[model samples]
Structures are given as structure tokens and as C-alpha cells.
Target: MSTSLYDADYEALRALLKILRVNAKLTQVQLASAMRVGQSYVSKIERGESFVDVLLFAKWCEACGISPGVALDGLRDQKRPGRAR
Candidate 1:
């Protein structure tokens, strides 16, 4: 297992979160407001510069109008090109 933020799974999480945000019609700034953080924070997470913890992930899901459970349901099958940590 790896702890790198740029890993494929993490990248998938970022992709999913960005999709959910767009689907929810929320901008990065809007999601940041809902998540109680600055826009750059959300951008960092989505760009894989920041490693998001479980609580933060849950908050992000809720901010995008979905439950953490729903987000996880679609996570496992997320595939992406491999990259070095």
C-alpha cells in the first residue's frame, strides 16, 4: 500500500469528487464555502497536492450533495493510468 497523494486511487477520488461537484452545479469556490475552506484547498485536493482524510472526504461528498456511502459505492471500480509516487 502507498501513502502518496498522486496514486491512481487517489487520482480517481479526485476525478470523482470533481465530477460530483460539477454534477451538483457547484464551482470550486462554492464547494470550498460549503466545506469551510479556501478555494485553493479544494483545488489542491482535486489536483492531488493534498491528501484528503476520511472526515474531509465525507465533508466533501456532503458539500456536493451526496453521501459518503454513495461516493464509495462508485470508488472501487475507478481505474486510471498508473503513475510513480
Candidate 2:
């Protein structure tokens, strides 16, 4: 299948989610519970098989005790190819 413009954004978002979760020392189950979502939903997101709604992304940031803008900034950084590590 062909990728869409949002593909990059989605991948970056997923990466940021994984990084934030690891940095916070939270498991998928814990994060899922915090977000009031299924653990599988978190897994799918981490695997880049799902697209997250902006409101849901905000909820995730809140659950992680972070500002949504901070998470968004990380995603933005990842979207830049050479900037990713």
C-alpha cells in the first residue's frame, strides 16, 4: 500500500509515544489504563497501525504528566529526517 502525507506524522507520533512511555517507566497496560483505552489500542498506536485523534493525544500527554505541546514538539523533531536519532 502507498503511504500518505500523514504517514510521517503518524510514525513520528508513535515514536514519541513510545519514547515518552519508556521515559516515564510506564508499561502499555498502565498507559492504557491511564488513557482509559484498551491495552491493544496502545499497542496498535505504538506499532503505527492506528491514527490518534488530537484529543486522544492530549489525553495521553495529560496521563503522562506532560504538556501536549511537549509531546507534539518531540513528534515534530522526529518528523525531520536528519534530526532523528
Candidate 3:
């Protein structure tokens, strides 16, 4: 599918990721540090200014103390209504 981070479904995924990070009590900088990336990278991902592949998504979930499987399931359940799959 040709979707950007700003797409509704993609945005939902980003929101869920941000929520996971918040629930884990990690600051953007903290998560970035865990991911070995710059804070701007985390910010960009959280703000839907960037997209993450499955591998990165898995790492991100783990870095935030969330299970990658659970995270993907959450994103799956968040599929936008009236949007084509």
C-alpha cells in the first residue's frame, strides 16, 4: 500500500506507539537513547513525519518495554474505518 505516516491508519499506529512510550515513562530523548538514535528521529516518528518498517517497529516496541507482537496487534486493530486494506 502506498501510504505515508500522515495517513489515517499510519497516524493511528504512530499514536499507539507514542502512547506505549508514554506509558513506559520514557521521554523522547530516553527512547531515542535506547534506540541509539537522535531525539529528532523519535520526534519525527511520533509526529508522523517519518515511517518505520517492521524491523524498526519491532525494535521501537522493545525499546519502550512493549511486546512487538502486541504492538502490531494494536496497530492492526486500529485500521481506519472506511479505508481500504
Candidate 4:
């Protein structure tokens, strides 16, 4: 079994988060405030220096007015092109 994310997975995760922020019409600072974290934390996540586990993921989704299920589905559905099913 794999122990890490594929490059496409990471890119997809980053894109999902960015899209969420944009859809919420939030600046990084604004999202940080709502998530009760520092702006750098949000930046780090966006830059893929950090990742959210399930609990934090849920919290982030809540803060962004998204459902955690949708985020999880996005993460799972970002299968790399040409990857065997």
C-alpha cells in the first residue's frame, strides 16, 4: 500500500482548498480568522507544507461552509490520468 500522496493527489488537494477559499470570497487572512489559525497556517496548507487530518479537515470544511463529505470525495476522485483503475 502507498504511504504518501501522488503528485496529482497533492495538486488536487491544493486546488480544492483554493477553490473553497475563492468560493467563500475569503482572503487568506479571512480564512485563517474563521479557522482560528494563523494566516501562515492557511498558507502552509495551500502550499502543501501541511495537511489536515480528518478532524481538522472537518473543521476546515465547516469554516468554509462546505461539507466534509464533498471534500473527501474530491480528494478521492482526483485520480491521475492514465492510472489503472
Candidate 5:
């Protein structure tokens, strides 16, 4: 499938990720520090300006104290109404 910032499901995933980070009580700066990158990296990812590959995603989940499997399930359950799968 084609991935883009405009894709509904992809956008939902990004939003969910941001929500997850917030729920974990980590600001972008904190999360970025945990991930050993600049805050701009986190901001860019949240803004969908960067594509998060699986390895990075797993690291991100780890930094947030989240299980990647659980996150994947959440991602799987994300489906916007009227959007083609």
C-alpha cells in the first residue's frame, strides 16, 4: 500500500502514537532523549514528516514503556470510517 501523510489510517497511527507517548507522560524532548535523538525527530515523526521503520518503532515503544505487540494490536484496530483498507 502507498503510505503518505494524507492517508487516513497512517494519520491515525501517527496520532495514536503521539497519544501513547503523552499517556506515558513523556514529552517530545524526554522521548527523544530516551531514543537518543533530537526532539525534532520526535516532532517530525508525530507530524508524519518522517517514516518510522519497525526497528525504530520498537525502540520508540520501548522508550515509552510500551510493548510493541500491544502497540501493533492498537495499530491494527485503527480504521477510519469510509476509508479503504
Candidate 6:
């Protein structure tokens, strides 16, 4: 796929998680602890190996000191109803 198309395929929620983690200078363990989850869970999220529900997403944003609106905006723009990329 072209870069643009690939960007569309990229899971925005996962990207947001990673960006938040990096911006906060927190390791997976640190973020996991702050979010009350296992380090492996954070790792899995970074690797795009799992999907997080809205509630968990909100919790993660809060832990990173980010507004849920900021975290969710990218995802909302990319996703479409009844469409699979």
C-alpha cells in the first residue's frame, strides 16, 4: 500500500497510546502501573496486538495526562461505519 493508505490502516488508537507514552517519558511498566494494568498489557497495546475499549482508552488518556478527546479524535476521523480496510 502507498504511505497514505498505510497510514489509514494504522490503528490510530494504538498510535495515540504510543505517542502519549513517549511524550510522558514513561516506560511500559510505568504506564501499566499508572493504569493499574500489567506491563505486558501496555506492550501488547504498543504492538497493536489488542484493541482497547472506550473505558480503558479513557483511563489510559487520564494516566498519561491527556484528554480523552485528544486520544479519540484520530480514531474517530479514520473509522467509518460498515467499512473494512
Question: Per-prediction RMSD in angstroms?
Answer: 4.5, 3.1, 3.6, 3.6, 3.3, 7.2
Is 3 or 6 the stronger prediction by lDDT?
3
List TM-score per model, in order: 0.86, 0.80, 0.85, 0.76, 0.85, 0.72
- For each candidate, the alpha-carbon lDDT, in order, equals 0.86, 0.82, 0.85, 0.78, 0.85, 0.76
> Over the full model, what C-alpha lDDT does candidate 6 score relative to the true structure?
0.76
lDDT of 3 by residue, 1-85 (tens): 6886578778878888899999999999999899888999989998878887888788789998889999887778667577554
Give the top-scoring candidate (lDDT): 1
Reference-based lDDT, residue 65, model 6: 90
* Candidate whose TM-score is highest: 1
Compute the lDDT for candidate 2.
0.82
Give per-residue CA lDDT, model 1, range 16-61, as digits (tens): 8899999999999999999899999999988888988999999999
**Candidate 3 lDDT trough over 10 residues, lowest sum:** 76-85
For model 5, the local distance difference test gives: 0.85
lDDT of 6 by residue, 1-85 (tens): 3333125345665776888889988888898999899999888877876667778888888888989997676567557776553
Model 2 CA deviation exceeding 4 Å by range: 1-6, 79-84
TM-score of decoy 4: 0.76
Error of 5 at 74 (Å): 1.3
What TM-score does prediction 6 earn? Answer: 0.72
**Stretches of model 3 off by over 4 angstroms after superposition:** 80-85
Clashes of 2: 0
Over the full model, what C-alpha lDDT does candidate 1 score relative to the true structure? 0.86
Superposed model 6: Cα runs more than 4 Å off: 1-10, 74-85
